[model samples]
Target: MKVGVVTFPGSLDDVDAARAARLAGHDAVSLWHGDHDLKGVDAVVLPGGFSYGDYLRCGAISRFAPVMSEVLTAAQGGMPVLGICNGFQILCESHLLPGALIRNDHRKFGCLDQRVRVENTSTPWTSSYAQGQELTIVLKNGEGAYVADEVTLDRLEGEGRVVVRYVGNPNGSLRDIAGVTNERGNVVGLMPHPEHAVEDLTGPGTDGIGFFTSLLESAATA
Candidate 1:
């Protein structure tokens, strides 16, 4: 499988996301934010970063990037896309996923090893894991709290779209949501940084490998 990792201005984790993809035995392509082409990648990842220096709003400016236009279309066409940290903000800004990330309830930047429970493992991005499985990944962000209207939250819960929830309420996200998937389960967004935990030598551990490996396994099944 070939996965593309998009790099926007000020993006800090594009290379790490690509490395994780490669470590999972897939070709990792570096995609530029200004490019409209996807280069025929089977899947895409909008890695964590402070694009445009988080001007206007976190990921608010990046939602208008040329690459995001393509990503939006591809994602609607059932292309699997994973958004992490700042990328998750962009996904919400683009309306690709539900809920909005706001300032942490503590009103401070949080950086720690966060434990998240896999709620729905049927999505293409999480199919490798069993439901209710818990894993720890690096979480670092200033505005990572996820919030939504009660109706929307109900719909998300009723439809089984809530993919991951925090084992501990670290960011004060609503209902302890750490991650979520779109209706079709093709697009997923999360506040934690899985790319930072894909390797044992340089990261916390290999707990993050499933995010990449699951994509490959999903593709094979498809």
Candidate 2:
């Protein structure tokens, strides 16, 4: 499988994402934010970093990048997309996934190994995980709190759209949500850095490999 990792100006983790993809047994393609083409990648990943210096909002400027047009269309067409941290903010900004990532309630930048429960394993990015499985991954961001209206929150909960929930409230997110997926389960967004955990020497463990491996497994099954 070929997975494209997009790099916008100021993107810090594109290289890490590509490395993770390679380690997961997929060809990793470096995609530029200014390009409209996806280069025939089977899946896409929006890695973390402060795009456009997070000027207008965490992901506000990145939502208008040229590459996002293709990403938006492909994601809607059932191509798997995983957005991590700042990437998750971009996904929300692009409306590919619902809800918003606001500033942490404590008004501080947070960085740590966080415990998250895999609530929904049906998504392409999560198939390698068992339901209710808890794993630790790196979480770092300034605006990581996820928020949505009561009705939307209710719908997400009722439909099992909630993908990951924080073991402990670290960012004051609504209902302790750490990640979510679209109705089709093709697109997923999370604030934790799964790519950082793909190697044991570099992270808590290799548990993060599941995110990339899950996509390949899902594709093979399909």
Candidate 3:
């Protein structure tokens, strides 16, 4: 399967995401934020970065990009989509996922290796992992706190949409939510940078490779 990684104006991890996709045995396609075309890829990944300089909000400006318009459409049609860090924020802004990412409770940027546990392995992007699997991945952002109304949170929890949760609650995210998936389980948005952790040479370890692998397996079975 071919996976397209979008590069927004300030995207910092688009290349890394593409590399991870390729390493996971899939074709990696480079996608531009200004392009309305998806290049006919099997899946899409919205990588981390301070898109559009994070002017109004972390992902507010980038959510209006031409590519995101297509992304939103494709995601609704069951094309697998994964969002990391700022990409997660854009997913929320685009209404592809629920809740919003806010400033860290500490009022400062956070950069560290965060430990998160997989709460659901049924999502397309997490099918390769076992439930309750723990992973240490890179986490860097200022606005990483996930917030949602109590009712919505309850619905997500009740429906098993909460895909992952921080093991130690690094950013004060509500209920320690580190990640979530859409109703169809095809779209996943998370705060951790799994792409960065796919290589042991440069990253903390290879614990993050399962995300890409899971997508590949899902595409094969689709």
Query: CA lDDT, every prediction?
Result: 0.93, 0.96, 0.94
Q: Count the backbone clashes (under 3 Å) in each candidate.
A: 0, 0, 0
Per-residue C-alpha lDDT of model 1 across residues 108-197, encoded as one tens digit per residue: 999999999999999888888898999889999999999999999999999999988999899889999999999999999999988999
Local lDDT at 198 for model 3: 93
**After superposition, candidate 2 runs with Cα above 4 Å error:** none
Candidate 3: residue 66 lDDT (0-100): 99
Give the per-residue Cα lDDT of candidate 3 at 109: 95
**Candidate 2 has what TM-score?**
0.99
lDDT of 2 by residue, 20-135 (tens): 99999999999999997999999999999999999989999999999999999999999999999999999999999999999999999999999999999999999999999999
**How far is 111's C-alpha from truth in model 3 (Å)?**
0.8
- Clashing pairs for model 2 are none
RMSD of each: 0.7, 0.6, 0.7
TM-score of each: 0.98, 0.99, 0.98
Prediction 1 global C-alpha lDDT: 0.93
| Candidate 2 residue-pair clash tally | 0
